[model samples]
Target: MKIGDLSLPEILKKTTATQGLCFDVGAFSIRLRSTHKNFIHTFHKLYRDFPVITDDQLIDFHIDMVIANNYRRWIKPQIIARIDGQQPFQAFAATHAMPLFEWALNWSIARLGQHYLMLHAAVLERHGKALILPALPGSGKSTLSAALAQRGWRFLSDEFCLVQPIHGQIVPIPRPTPLKNESIAVIRNFDARVFIGPLFEKTRKGTLGHLRAPTASVDCLKQTAAPAWIVFPQYQNQAEVLLEPLSKSAAFLKLASNSFNYTLLGATSFNLVKTIITNCDCYNLSYSNLDDVIAQLDVLSDNAQ
Candidate 1:
């Protein structure tokens, strides 16, 4: 059953401040135990489309967010995120529970989910082919990916591009895309139908909010896509939209640098990266207009098909 199938009261009972809640996100199952009511409430809404698994199902990650035990719990409270009973990060203010949860889950996947070659990129699918957007921070990758999903492209992931090592297939791990600062406002203005959660002010990445993943993408979590195009996106103010063709050799090095476990996987990663670059078209995209960029991408997808 889906998380939305349960009422708020029922969710509280199952995810009691003590017992925790378990849900599936693409290939991984997570058991998150949090006492922060706001975080739980927001999670329930943002992840309403995801399946809720029974306690008997195998859980890949066990997470806990508990208020500090000292006097701080009452005076300017703080929260700690623990995975497998070990704290992997410094404590964050209790008010930032949602961001903390999102960050912790990302950490868990990047550090422990070594079965796949993980690239720090956003991925989406259309016509059975995947589009990989890999870029550094402030590159508008998340913004572009979220916009594409709204325009009917299936969202695979916003934070990670998980690729099956054996066959170079892109796996879907759709989660809430965190839109930081101005991007949140930009997305809200871009689409009237989009659902964004409440804003969390003064976080490390500046004031940020999460854009909910489309239900259609979450529903098709089992479907995987082969890489079709690799586009490195950058957003510049008032810049003309430009999509330049990139050489395969340059694409390989750039993609390899964007990966989380490229060095760890050694030759396996090398061969897989080569295979992906050789089969897919690559481009460098710079734009200030979201609509124009998306339209150009749509034309490319249509032409390919």
Candidate 2:
């Protein structure tokens, strides 16, 4: 049954208890347990559309977020992330539990999901054509991604561009887009309908919040689209939107450098990247205004016919 099928009271009862709760997210099933009241409340709201596991289903990642230790609980109070009973990262303040969960899950997928050539990019699709926006950190990738997803575009993923090599198709890995610092306000003011989670402050990424993916996106999780465009988006302050065509060689190099597992996949990665670029138009977009870039993308997608 869908998580929405259960009431808030029911979700809290299942998750806060010792047995934990399992939910199916696209191709992966996560069994998460957290007793922290605020964390549970946030989880229930952000993931309400996902289906909860009711039967005996195998869980891919068994995770937990809780206050660590008995003595330290009286002190500054820190939260720990346990994956299969092993804690790999250092603890953070208990207040930062939500962003911690989001980052930890991303770490799990980036490290263990070897089947797909994962890229550090935000992906979205329209009319069976996918756009891969790969960029370095602080390039305004997440901001642009959130704006697009809030608008008319289909949200695929904000952090990962999952590429299945054999078919040369982009897998849908839709999840809440993590908006950091200024991006938090940017999206909130940009889209009135956007359902943003609580502001998580003082994390390593500064003040953070999560924009839940559109309901339409979660319902179409089974659909996969081929890469039809590759745009490297960079947000600049007070600068006009600029969209420039990029060469295949340049695009391939940029994509390879930004991917999580490009070199690891060897020749298979090389062939797939080349094929994607060859079939798609590559562009370098620098924008300060969201509306201008959105309009430009509309024209670009329409001409892709």
Candidate 3:
């Protein structure tokens, strides 16, 4: 029920309650466990939150991992992750939990995670339709996603749109999209609904935390959203918010490049992407304003419907 009450492994596994990842983090308790004990715990002291119910679960998937490493040779471990703190009780999410979560996401999408497949994308939904935002790190995809969600769209994921190959639709992996630097302030200033997670003091990626996704998005985990639009987002200075028409060919190329598992599926992956781009309205959106982008997307959806 709460982070401190449940054991570490139980917390992560609780995500199986839906079909996605679960998070049980706070100021006091910081521990994580999956089906294995290969996780590290950096912190050594218990937190003060005790049992305030800072637990989140995502039970929307079946995972698969292709683990290869020197450690595997000895005991066959599938994943490696950062523990809470040096003392072993404080959970520094980026250093401890997020990495494991990524591997878990990779597993949920497919039963494999070798070097060949990948994507730089985030997922969210409305009604039952899912929107996949595939863009690079600096591309303002997260900003657009957060903005859309606050305005109305269900936030399925800020990053990682898990594509279930057999079903041929994106699997919802709802989690906070990490917002760095000014974007954090931008989101907080933009909307009070946005749940910005605990901010770390200093790290390689600068300060980081999870952007809380709406609970409704996670609740509708079983719904299937047909790929409606494949829009590559870019935030540019001095640029007006506009969605540019993009050819299916260019869209496919860019999307594949952004994918996390394009090469892994080979022809199957190619066909999946082709079907998506073909059926979806493809575009290149450039904007310096969130309001402008949000308004245009709403208008576009209304016209499409």
Top candidate by TM-score: 1
Off by over 4 Å in 3: 1-31, 34-118
Error of 1 at 13 (Å): 1.2
Estimate the TM-score of every prediction: 0.98, 0.96, 0.68
> lDDT of each model, Cα atoms only?
0.91, 0.86, 0.59
Tens-digit lDDT track for model 3 on 86-192? 12122233333444444444443344333223356776666556667898888888888988878888766666665656656765555456677778998898987
Question: Model 1: which residue pairs collide?
Answer: none
**Per-residue CA lDDT of candidate 2, range 1-305, in tens?**
77877887888788777778898777578888887887888888898888788536888888899888867789878899898788988887888888888878988898788788888899999877998999998999999988888778898898889999879888887888888899888888998888999898877788888888899998877788899999999888998989999999999999999888888999988888889889999999999998888988988888987
Give Cα distance to truth, residue 48, candidate 2, Å: 1.2
Ranking by TM-score: 1, 2, 3
